[model samples]
Target chain A: MSHDHDHDDHHHHHDNHFSPMEARVRALETILTQKGLIDPKAIDAIVETYETKIGPRNGARVVAKAWAEPDFADWLKHDATAAIASLGYTGRQGEHMRAVFNDAETHNLVVCTLCSCYPWSVLGLPPVWYKAPAYRSRAVIDPRGVLAEFGVTLPEGRKIRVWDSTAELRYLVVPERPAGTDGLDQEALADLVTRDAMIGTGLALEPEAEA
Target chain B: MSRCETLADSPGLPVSAEGEPVFAEPWQAQAFAMTVRLHEQGVFTWAQWAEVLSREVHRPGRAVDGADYFDCWVTALSSLLSERGVASEAEQSALSDRWARAAEATPHGMPILLDNAG
Candidate 1:
């Protein structure tokens, strides 16, 4: 989080202190800067891209919109890329998108076995576990076991569909809207959409979760 | 995008199967972004970066059998920096040791503070 000439940036990260990983990165950044090999502003800009432009919140907005509008839900089911782009979530790693809905009869899981291909525009960066070898391999070979490990136990009658994303396509799971959300607005509904839910590993927050 | 260029260049590096760029850990993402940005900024060509990474992978004393591509990337970057005189081996390891000591001495779940001045 180094900003070469920005004292404000320093003050901001110094709130308590930086994390161990952040400290390590900072050490490298400080040295690279001294050698004129890197510009702190450039690093800041990259960080900003994910922090602001890309995040799970974008996908939540799409999910919320879909939930509030049945027609948009149909649109998401049919042409997710166009529908998502309509919300300005178009960019690298999200050019081609698909929305898979989770239901009582069926559950969907996403994985990229060859490599870690994710919807960066919508989900930001993939989590460490998502990219770990164990998750990547298990998500395909033993999907039910994987979901079980995540504490997601589908119904005995339910079938699980594992989507192995290639380099050109990405998938997002639209978790079923929980009960009692009937009166919630789109923003509030979006608030219930957890990043894990979109990744097909966790459920959305219950309507009363905020309370 | 050319960002895919570097990812594709490395033999064992993760290539986009059908998903966007992913960094498993924060450091991985940082390293991934740094590699791409540096390439974009003309610090190194994708080919050069890719070559250095392959060399680092096969380099002795490093975990060659491990699947940590970013570790290879970090070593490669350090080597390139030292070779180019941007920084030396002594300086790099010195800083890393300081961070390691700070991390080990810090209480569990506490923020690590390097005792550099102390």
Candidate 2:
């Protein structure tokens, strides 16, 4: 398969050669940089921000706070944008926000049916599957099936609500806190929250699972 | 099932060992960063970027698995650059051709300098 071949080549060569797409990207960057349209440093900074600094860890902290504090939970439900921004997480693709809390009878899943509109400030970039047409189309139609593929099987009586993110607004799913974690602090709680959990594709790790 | 197996089952959805989504190639990330950086620079609004991206993503005969996502992104960015008069299509293509030649001339394991094209 092409994917396998590419993977093998990547392992052996280690950036010795550029693929057609890679070359195109490089060319575009060089041209834009020369024209003063974009700074190479700024490009590196943006990529570095997404790759190393911003990620689900930010969302996990938010989720942890909500689990430990009821007032924050209420604020998140009412005005997610301000609540999230208050925590110093506010920027593009996250200007408008809504925190969908999974409860005993209801589960929330976020998807961008039109395109990959994700809460970047809080949760970082969307996952590969999150942007795939299969997930985008089937998420709203057959959420349970998609969840099952991700190894989550909700109770038959539970209702699944899929939120379709748009350019104007985005969603952050507050997964249900795993049981028997009353003693844990916010920082400890954050460790249990995974990226998929916030997207409602998986559950937060059990307290024991973390150990 | 293993993560690799799961990913193989679901085409085009690769993940890192930590289970986080990763860019398959550095170019994809570069293309993505360019769009965001340009938007931040007011070259285009996020709404405009979204509109063009959505159109490119939904275009007929595109890959459904999103393997061509960055390709569409580059195309959408190019279209916006032309529409917004930031750069003409001809200018961008000429530069692209020059970069291609530069890359061809550059020695292995060295940077592909634009100066090499001349």
Predictions' DockQ, in order: 0.08, 0.13
Label model 2 with its docking quality class.
Answer: incorrect
**Stretch of 10 with least lDDT, candidate 1 chain A:** A10-19
Candidate 2 per-residue lDDT over residues B5-118, each given as its tens digit? 323432233355665445544466678778767766677876677778778878999987887877777787788888998778788777777766776565442445678779
Candidate 2: list runs displaced more than 4 Å: A1-55, A114-116, B1-28, B31-118
Q: Extract clashing residue pairs from model 2.
A: none
lDDT of 2 by residue, A1-211 (tens): 9999988866652222344565667777876787787898777665554464234778999999999999999999999999999999886423488899999999998876423245656776565456556887788778999999998999889999988765567788999999999999999999999888998888899999999
lDDT of 1 by residue, A11-115 (tens): 432212233444456567668777676776676556444442234788999999999999999999999999999998885433489999998888888875323
Best of the candidates, DockQ: 2
After superposition, candidate 1 runs with Cα above 4 Å error: A1-55, A114-116, B1-29, B32-118
Per-candidate chain B TM: 0.75, 0.79
